[model samples]
Target: MAICTHHPTMKQSRTNGGRKKEDTRSNAIRQSSGISNHLFEALRALRYPDRARLLWVDRFCFNQDNTEIDLMFSIYSKATSVIIWLGKENPVTKTAFEVMDSLAYIICRERNGAGMKGDNISPFAMKERPSDCSLFLNGQDFFCFSFSRKGPKMYRLPRHGSLGDDAIFRFNDDRLWTEIDGILSNSYLERAWIVEEVAAAAEVNVFRGKSNMPWSVFWAAYLGRQIFAFKPHMASDPDASYGAI
Candidate 1:
């Protein structure tokens, strides 16, 4: 998978007489605009130059002020390969990539009629089965993350109540797949849920006047087990000895 990092330009705020004041509407608008520009720049850096076709980013294409446009963008996220650019060393970036990679692998294997190993099951699982079914049912739980200048952070935002065995079973019900597929395909309401679930899972605070936190801190919580990291230079350089997890 290709990796992209978002670097946002944030404005420092001041406390007024021991009381914190909310950002003015105009200031909020300016910050949003800056974030959008940063998103575009990140996309440009991450894109494969030779391949004309690349992933789509909402900040560049969607109008933040328009509800209709925002809903449309949310729908698009479910269908598209989304990369949240929450700056460097973001925990959200790490966890999101981990979840996305696992989901992608599970989905691809299942689509081709394959099964994943039991030992590889994530700690959040109750019993060992094919990862594909688990992902299809519980993938949304791993979607929430926070994005900030400090980095992207991840959270456990589950749509289907708890992560117990019974809940997992219900999520894997045949009826649910039909509904999920339909949601994945098309429909405004379903799409809204998909976006909302992902946004919630990602711990994204789209509203103005919120506390700021580092993204890396959120993702670090989920980094236990077989997760691995490597330097880009090490991967690109032929002379370098690449290590395995």
Candidate 2:
């Protein structure tokens, strides 16, 4: 259960057998406050079906009247991990994350090897077979480590003024590019506080429904998208394809 303040009356009780009935008592204190339906949906989506989860909500935990802006940075910095809620998942989210997972996995692997420096920073590398896999963020399979468990095939990104033939073939699908656009165009990324929160976070996990990916991976994929757009090949229709984000 989430530990929150602002409510009063901390009633305590004990069972006859000498065991405390913690579940029987209300976990959070009762108070009257207007909660947005969007926030409610986020809280519901984060709940664990089999067990309780300890969550810290800024609105509930922070004393807005007395709290300083610096406190938010400190809290996020010290927290175990930051969860970035991107709202309920849909077909667009699923497709976007699938592409991101593959690209980020490639970036991770490269970082461990020769490192992402020089021209190698681009994700235009190849493997045995293309990863035609999909991750369904349904039920209890919402783990961030799932991508590391099985290696997904990586697609190529534009590099050195051109998208190589192999990369061009892989990126033939306009639908795939559309999904990538969807991720960047999400309104959640435009929040004013996100910059400080993410900058202060020790670890960041982005969530869209049950689907999740590391901030490093997501950022890398985003950078790749930017690089891909400005390639010489895309210069012909720059205005039509690339819009300022």
Candidate 3:
């Protein structure tokens, strides 16, 4: 697995005499396994009853040499899974994960139950989706079939005439958008390097603390919100080719 996380660092004390410390951030991760950040904490929390989880975190795994730097994209792309760390944990983030879990259940059930209309997003169809994909509110798979015996909570998805419990209709409404955006506008998403990281991954997870959501569900809802809320004049056809969306 590949972990994409925000590395928060602090300046260490000056040495007895000479020059300032170079590569403190890298040093921190190496010396402490990112104890100062959430990456190690989140990884440590990943547990399974049966076997061990192998991970390839950028901070500790990479040598920080030219060869490793050059292969950054390669490492990310080749990884079987990608875990995105948003931040620590909070009540608002918990609710977000609940909503995300519900969405995943709704989408999966909708796809399984003989056919629904809007945005036929079938995440259970793992043949089409990488099984390594996942998302977290606080950072656990709320719907991992193999890991968790308890299934995901199915929330009502937004329909054309009906609204769901989610923030689908709130994109245009700055007031409602802020509620969700406030929690999501953390350090991770604001980075300039995350574009390639997110786009290249066949499977990805959005994590906060312990709550989680499937990336597919999040993406589908995101597109739905964008098409409907951002531009009223744009085509909202369910069957229309959104191209990658």
Clashes of each: 17, 0, 14
TM-score, ranked from best to worst = 2, 3, 1
RMSD of each: 18.8, 12.1, 13.8
What TM-score would each prediction reach against the true structure?
0.26, 0.52, 0.46
Model 2 lDDT tens row, 170-238: 465555555466555556667666787778765666776676666656776655454444322222222
Candidate 3 runs further than 4 Å off: 1-34, 63-67, 100-179, 220-245
Question: Pick by TM-score: which candidate is best?
Answer: 2
Tens-digit per-residue lDDT, 117-232, candidate 1? 43343433334345444334433433444453446556443334345433532333443333222211222223333344344332332100111222222223122112221101
CA lDDT, candidate 2, residue 195: 80
Candidate achieving the largest lDDT: 2
Worst 10 residues of 1 by lDDT: 225-234
Where's the lowest-lDDT run of ten residues in candidate 3? 10-19
Candidate 2: worst 10 consecutive residues by lDDT?
134-143
